[model samples]
Target chain A: MSKGNATKLLGAATLGLMVAALFMVFVYAPAEATQGDVQRIFYFHVPLAWVAFAAFAITAVAGLFYLWLGYPVFDQLAYAAAEAGVVFCTLVLVTGSLWARPIWGTWWTWDSRLTSTFILWLLYVGYLALRAALADGEQGARMGAVFGLVAAADVPVVVVSVRLWRTIHPAVLVTREGSHGLADARMVATLLVSMVAVTAVFGWLLALRVATLRAEARLRGLAAELLALERASEEN
Target chain B: MRAMAAVLLKDVVVELRGPMTTTALATVSLLVLVVLVFAFGPVWGQSEPTAAAGALWVALVVSGTLGGGRVVAVERERRCIDALVLSPLDRGGLFVAKSAAAFVFILVAEGFSLIVALLFFNLAADAALARTAAVLALGAVGFAGLVTLVGAVGGRAKGRDFLVPLLAVPLYVPALIAGVKASADALGGARLGEIALWLKVLLSCDAIFVAAGLLLFEQVVAGSE
Candidate 1:
């Protein structure tokens, strides 16, 4: 009923779902005929990609809300999404890299998906870093909101450019496309389950982060008030 | 129109008068080319058009980051950004004007870099230079457009020199990839139509970046006070 109770319930539910998803990923998802167990990473990897994009989309939507309403709550929402988005984006790159090493035989490549994901990672990593560097006030929030918008806008452009770039340069290997992953019903089921589970994880992280930021803001406000009271008492 | 021109004109006049930023940009660009010399060492010669294209664009990107980061820095330093922000001109106009000026300045620096490349790389001299120029110009516009926004955002944020480039350069990735390939095609004397796709991609990048800066610049410059 209470807000705290609701968060705890959500947290416990997501944690359970994620544990089940992990089981599905490692056990339920049958290994590919070609790539073997290495192909199993796809279950988690695809969901990470999905959730990261979703998180970034949240940042953009929340930022627009902040801009239109001049509300700090929306800004806080954007900040939470941006921070979580960066973490997921980093995992996407790392998972993609790990997947690539076993399959593509390289640590990294300029493939369309990987390239766009990398660019997305860089933009938001910078966003979080920039927010940290700014004065923790309305100015920081406003600037961060703008950065969120810019990063969101670039996602499509990066995808298109990377696709074009990939076409110009031959695709060395096609993995994780419709041909392989979708054909197997178990793999498909595993992927679907993981996507739901990972999304729940995203929601959990976002809510927790937003709450933490709010508490920090409150602490800062209380500190300022305490200082003011001290100054007033000294004068009296 | 008058206000936009004034912003552009002031940037040009200041750069022409002092040439400090240009000098710094030129020096860094030249240094990058020198590093390319190591890349294209004994086996690779100046006649390598592909290598030349790669080197030229990397040099351009490096210099552009350093130069472009200063777009808002100069304004912030003189506290002229406050003046610009307070001006009656719409934020979109200011963004367009600032981008135009930065684009032209980058082009100038790239032109000088081209000349230096000609001497160092012994690049192809014929019809390809024209296409290379086109690719460079389009790429510069796109690069400047996005970087100016980054500069504004980063400059206004707390003191982090690397922040703008880190944030902006990734966005610049699409343009850079398109430009490098297009430039390489041009240097190879590939037909205009052969490179048409790259040109189109570059144009779209330029358009999107300009539109983005125009639309979002107000948000970036608007004070939260």
Candidate 2:
């Protein structure tokens, strides 16, 4: 199949998987004993968090690869992934707060996970800002790649430090680990299927974003060539 | 190694030759401490150490932000950045030289700030004080490594005075949080082991930022766009 067709197929597959996931999340998975139905947000929230991490991992790896190989394409990949990562990270925070408000009786708390997530958001937002603040070509890309790699590499340290800084997380108040250890096979399957679905969606969004960037770069190149020709003709 | 040492030695010589950035920040640090003292409502109270810790870190961070980026700025202002870029020194070695030199200046300013903080706040001069000093040293290493690199890029921006702090502070949060906590623990008479986690954070941050500075120094110190 052609590349466009393949992309179309992937999108359709994501949609199908998402529909299946919605069924499993609502119909298949059993409600928790304590939190009841609001607990269902866990499936989406956790998967979104996972995708955020994965997206950032892609950004970091691509950034480092760009630095080593000096390829504009790698930098492009890193930038695209960072944009997607930031979007997913925002979803993670919003969904997490939503979940927290219903179950933890508060809209927000300075728990380690939440705080680390917030900082992760800040770092990437800073990454985007730094990218914008610099030259728009290879120089900016190079600087951004450096910042991306450094910031991503520092994430583990951030998590550890934040956790050490605050130990009283709401996780202690209520258990949300692996379906609350409910051991219900259907519930487990639902969580797994949902994770797969969102991950697929994440992939699709990443590809779309990258393709847009690539096209934009191509157009910019064409425009620059046209302008250069125009200037030469005028000078002659 | 020789190139790196030469770069460092040059900075020290240049600094010692004149008052430059350090002397200016010393005065600023003292003024900041006075403001902090007033805000904390007299530091000689029962909770002086607690207030003193905050004052100390803020002073250190402020002084650090002002002085950290200026070394590179002065180089740029004097067209020394171009010379340094053209030099035969390895970029990583240049990074090492710059960060090491920046760390020394930062240490001096921090020492002065610490004295100012202690005298004004009337902080205790016991074992806890020694521990806090150690925390300051460890934290400064990481802070210096980061600000040196950040300052290199940030000092080039049109709004560098703002940009340098904007770039440096986010990266400094982890170290600052850990350092402040550890300082509090020390001042509260907690044993070293009890504050081990905070110390670990500081150590890891220091190591990571130093290694990162070394690796990415090439990108930072590259020729103009």
lDDT string for model 2 (A80-166, tens) is 888888998999999988988877778888777788899898888877777767766777778888888878878888888887767
**How accurately is candidate 1 docked according to DockQ?**
0.73
Error of 2 at A180 (Å): 3.7
lDDT of 1 by residue, B1-225 (tens): 999999999998989899877787788888999898886657675447777788889988899888876877888888888899989889999999998888887888888888888888887567897778778888998889888988888886666578877887888787888888999889988887998888887888888788888988898888722
Interface RMSD of each: 1.3, 1.6
Model 2 lDDT, residue A114, Cα? 85
Candidate 1 per-residue lDDT, tens place, A34-150, comes to 888887887888899899998889988998888889877888889999888888888888888897888778989877777778888888888889899898767788888888887
Clashing pairs in 1: none
B1-225 in candidate 2: lDDT tens per residue? 888898989999988999687787677778888887777674457877767777778877888888887877888888888888888998888888888888888788778888877777667678888888888889989988888888876665556787677767777778888888888778878878998878988899999889998888888778643
Clashes of 1: 0
